[model samples]
Target: MAIVKLSTTERRRLSVFFTCLGLAIVAWIFTTLSSPLPFIINEALVYKNSPQKKAFHPLQADTIKITIQGTGWQMLFSKMKPDSKPITVDLTPLESRNYVVLSSQLKLINAKRDANQQITAIDPDTLYFDFTNRLTKKVPVRALLGIDYQKQFAISGNVSIKPAYVTVSGPADRLQKIDEWKTDSIKASNVNESIATRINLQPVTEGNLTIYPKSVQVNIPVDEFTEKTLDIPVKLINNHNYDNVKVFPQKVKVTFTTSLSRYKDMSDDLFEATADLDLWRDHGYSTLPVQLTRFPPFCKIVKVSPANIDFIIKK
Candidate 1:
């Protein structure tokens, strides 16, 4: 069985060295299958049966897009993570704009990829979303507190909110633009005493908003004051003929600070002291500027003492 031909220039140089080794193995298999290797499955595309009652707007928690076909050295050793069984978009039977992953469900992310690595694709491959209709309302819980009383004490009555109101739900045009529901600042400094706790409901998220009692129970009623002088007796506002205009110390010595439970119901007739004869100051010793016009609510004036008095203009 001898057949060593080896002629005609050695068989045309062995057919040009086997056609240049078959064009270098067809250019290394066409650069390893068209060199496709784009990975970015940060995670999130595994939604299964979402939509728990008409509030669908949050379902892409990982920015997915895994394309693989290796050759970049077998995708750097096939360590391409991201495939814990995701890519499942159920949405409770989808009804509006369906197809959130229909290419045969991408074989459940190509069976967790890695062996032969052929995810080939999976970038939005088909997606759509939009949902609403799930509203409830009760609102009436405003208490963004941040009081810092102590210099003379303040804040008495009507700042409480133990069930004052709450029952928010979202999407009815955003709960009709919400009526009320504030409480997340809640701060207190030096406060003399009294300020209960529990307060957090100012998130208001957005789309699928909700707040049913997220947190509310603030009773700020601090009371620890006691500075009251009250010399009272100085009335005469807009005096144009108040019997002939006359005011030179009619009486003005009110110093405020009530909070000891209304400091004995605060005397001096709740306070009025007025004397603004249009702020008379004709510069004829007509001095006139002590005005109180009623004051009393956590009281804390402190000084007024003839803050400007003595008038007698009578053109």
Candidate 2:
């Protein structure tokens, strides 16, 4: 094929023509997007004024389709961001009726929204709810803790929660199923000192349920621990025959760790060590094993001298 060549002036004119065409296309797009028009978008709904005497569950999804009138640019952006803040819907009307008309709330809803993008209409126009018997109950709050104490440090007393129980109000059936509410996990390492802080309760996922005072104050008493030794007399148990039986060792030294604050309060009276004669009689064992029948709950037993004891039985 023969090649066709153009002069320098002709080439320049061609380039200018295409550039103008591109500019016109760009201007057309901007003008179209700047026009005001109606567009549809979905928005989440937030409820207020929930009835105290009745528990309600929405009959439909918690979202509504809204027709908004705004410039094309606003519509485009709204479409891109479907997760904008939810529109607050008043549920006061539910107290007298089972449904609420969205049209009536348009004025209030629009008052808080930007003027550039106004909501024109709501799909489904009305909201409906299912009602159930409301029940209020108090449930204990349980704390979840993950703590690592430093050397010779430990919890000195019971962990205290300011409000031991939380008030929950919801559908009777739902509330009945809930026995207790728990706080979020409290985690720490090298926890040498007492802890005092506010912790949030696990949120109620069911929209119809409500919990009062979403958070509670926690107090954990921590203290340094030291070793304590006590000579506790070993008592004989299950000596049914009342035979004269004497254990070689009458007392054993018990070494345990207790909180420094309670060190002075520790004594042999708080512990009970016993030798079970039943062990020797039932199994014909040569020696009786000594065991601690009772001890302080907070103390950690470290060493018990002479775990097994020799006994003499006079026939």
> By TM-score, who's the top model here?
2
Q: Write the per-residue lDDT of candidate 1 for residues 170-211, one digit (tens) a residue.
A: 668767888888889987788888878887778654435656
Candidate 2 wrongly placed segments (more than 4 Å) = 1-46, 58-89, 99-128
What's model 1's lDDT at 41?
39
Model 1 clash pairs are 43-62
- How far residue 262's Cα lies from its native spot in candidate 2, in Å, is 0.9
**Model 2 per-residue lDDT tens digits across residues 7-60:** 999999999999999999999999999998898888888888889899988898
What is the Cα-based lDDT of residue 276 in candidate 1?
65
- Tell how far residue 23 is off in model 1, in angstroms: 99
TM-score between model 2 and native: 0.69
In model 2, what lDDT does residue 182 have?
A: 95
Model 2: residue 279 alpha-carbon error in angstroms: 2.8
Residues forming the 10-long window of minimal summed lDDT in candidate 1 = 81-90
